[model samples]
Target: MSKGKAHAALTIAGSDSGGGAGIQADLKTFSALGVFGTSAITAITAQNTQDVTAVEPISNEVVAAQIKAVLDDIRIHAVKIGMLGSPALIETVAQSLKDFDGPVVLDPVMLSKSGVALLPNDAVEALVSILVPRATVLTPNLPEAAKILGEDEARGDDAVLAQGHKILDLGAKAVVMKGGHAEGETCRDWLVTPEGATHLDAPRIETRNTHGTGCTLSSAIAAELAKGADLEAALTRAHGWLHGAIQAADQIDIGHGHGPVHHFHEVWT
Candidate 1:
């Protein structure tokens, strides 16, 4: 235990070779926000802005061991989970985090922007049954919310709020119902709990560089939570930061298709 170590948040997710999403995006967001970052990689992905060519999930034993190694030693303050490919892998993560007392930010990553599936059909059940109940805050896009609840994708505000409550009924303490898929000029993401709901609304920027927005936002929330921000405050701050990042995404040109947001937007200028 170092004397002056920063607040630490652990990201248990896949590795994106393109450095846009998953472990790479999570770590980048943590570092950008002055939080110490740690990771337990569940899978390795061969992807770019254009496509996800291949994916190789780490064995369950290895994934569990990675999580154990970090939890046993590091003083973790928060955890963000993403992209567990199978039922066994989801179960492994749930079991590994069973004893963790800090906030768990669960981002239900189902597919890439290029239409490549990340979580399989059967694994979605395990995620809802196992991990969703354990989540401190479940962050799910519109389609993901529908998938979790076995309903059609939510479109308008009323439907979105309705689904958000349904997700809270699944036993998550709260949910961030992302409105990226909704048809509107403003992107409104609801932070819904059993208590009530608030929103972080920003004007939707027209850009093709939204590759890792979900991963980045979830990890940013984790980082803020590690720094002792309450769930509402964390969502507000993370949303503002991500909006800035997305606005500055065009400043950098990395890939051919959907490029990454400028994670270092605050620092690199």
Candidate 2:
């Protein structure tokens, strides 16, 4: 390890009491990838892997303060944005990052697998108009992409590239469309940059412990970016890391429901 310096990645998102997702998943993934992690919680949820029972959004002022506190003191190398609860949060978060030049991975977390709504309906508009353009990399699953684009659906091999471009037009340096929702033996994620597009595929690991895959993946990408990886390299490495975690998910039984992927698979192996 380096003598005094540490690569830092900040997660601005919600908190999951169950610790399977949200800031919990993000920070855990960061530590697993050897990055110093910080967080500004936008919402607090009484949630387990199976269900999200309650949600309370923090005040926009406080969210701004938490981000400022970290930015003022720490030299954050990357920032991962996730699960902003409202339009106010979307606006404030964008304002906070408007000046930051570091890598920013925005995960458009719209719903919980248990059918809980993470981002409010109105906030979707703000996310598109405000945060999308500022993001260094935008990550959205199939359903989330449809919601943001006001489309009914996005599936199929061609839908991946089409959806990625439509999202790229929404304003991001690049887009990574996650394929977990699509039906197939293989899950494909496409990375679309201005120059071109590249895709990665992996056999889907069937399990209920897929609770926090999105948050973990985005946070891992931010961690790699904090370590100065290029966009393609960061996504490739992050994808492989998430695959390992998911494959090793059953190694522990944390909760009774969907459970969580093993974030420290590499560390404690």
Candidate 3:
């Protein structure tokens, strides 16, 4: 057994039966980063790399109970939230985390890679009003950021930075505007905080196996935070780690369509 301060993180998210994204990816990332993972599943997604066929959210009471159970027992150093399927779920999660002071990495997973809306229209308001305020770090892709702000997708650096500041205005302590959806040779993720912005850029590795990139990145940051890294350090570590995972994605084959990043890429070899 490993001897040291045990790092644990709680993930409040959906479950993907295909083992590519959602809770599976969150847990995989936590384990890979040497953090113990706990979970409160908000929804169950019958999803594969190709599509999300069906989604069923757990009862709000059950979701709350799961979070309570974990917090009542374990020492969760950080929390990563993803895929809350409804307004009520978002409110519940926000209430559940109200007392905890640990870092909260909120990945606003609005749409699937195939363009299916994971979060509905009504719930967006609730997420903004309730959960966004509590987030220590809000991770949103280009389209997700646009949807959150009810604006057109940011096109240039100036537009993206303007939107990032707008999102910070919504009460998030920080925002990571992912550049994956943008047309670019280099994916440049902007880490915008109250102080300023930092550019996290990496060469775009061409690969179809990017099923859980967002989930993995956010969870990995939470994992790093659980290990006591500061906000910028955590984001930097997660970004670098995800780049490696995506680069090594072709080492394994999973689905017929977009496969998952290699969460254990460093260890599997």
Candidate 4:
């Protein structure tokens, strides 16, 4: 057996009480991908497949403490960041991660799939000013990207790609725009870096089990990074893994509404 610490990936997000998304999903993704998972929860949500009924942001002190505690003990090889509920908490997380040196996948989650707002209205500026600059890769869906770019909606590929480059100008090492919300038969994504942009396309899987897909994809990227995969390889592996998970989503019966993807599809298949 391998000795010493296992390949570690840290997820700084919220706790989904329903056990299908947020921290729960992130941890599952890390484990399924063969990486040890750690978490520092920023909020607690009483949510399930249907909706997020409640969200209680954790104290800033405790949030910082959790990050510190994990970093102090384990050598974090990669970091996956999700939902910071407020501007103060966003700053707190940014401050806590200031000393941590690793590839970070920042999932700028704005709202739950059920259309409940997660990030506060006022925290957008703080998130843009602080965390985006530090993020190794900022992953944002269409709505999130539109909000970040101060647009009512980001329309076509040209507009979406333009806004993506604009966000990258804010200082993230890279920007990945998720095209799930884009209108088309095929799902599209563009990875924008200083060098240029790479287009990635796949047939969008139609299923209600897309819950926590964003979290799973980002965490899988972190896991791949923990295993020392380069950016391209990491993203490719993560996308493939997530697609497989979605393809196998209906294998389990979890809840009444949207369900979760099979995180260990690779292992079982």
lDDT of each: 0.95, 0.92, 0.94, 0.89
Assess the local accuracy of residue 71 in candidate 4 as a C-alpha lDDT between 0 and 100.
98
TM-scores of the candidates are: 0.98, 0.98, 0.98, 0.96
The sequence of per-residue lDDT tens digits that candidate 1 reaches over residues 1-269 is: 36787799999999999999999999999999999999999999999999999999899999999999999999999999998999999999999998999999999999998899999999999999999999999999998999999999987888999999999888999999998888879999999999998888899899999999999999999999999999999999999999999999999988899999999999997
The ten-residue window of minimal lDDT in model 2 covers 152-161
Q: Indicate the TM-score of model 2.
A: 0.98
Winner by lDDT = 1
> Which wins on TM-score, candidate 2 or candidate 4?
2
Tens digits of per-residue lDDT, candidate 4, 1-269, equal: 27876899899999988777899999999999889999999999999989899889899999999999999999999999998988889889888988888999999988998899988779888899989999999889989988887886778888888998999899999888888788877888788899898877888888888888888888888899999998878888888888889889998868988888899887875
Q: Cα lDDT of model 2 overall?
A: 0.92
User: In each prediction, how many residue pairs overlap at the backbone (N, C-alpha, C within less than 3 A)?
Assistant: 0, 0, 0, 0
* 171: Cα error in model 1, Å: 0.7
Q: Deviation in angstroms for 141 in model 1?
A: 0.4
For candidate 4, the per-residue lDDT at 247 reads 86
TM-score of 4: 0.96
Which segments of model 1 are wrong by more than 4 Å?
Answer: 1-3
Ten residues in a row with the worst lDDT in model 1?
A: 1-10
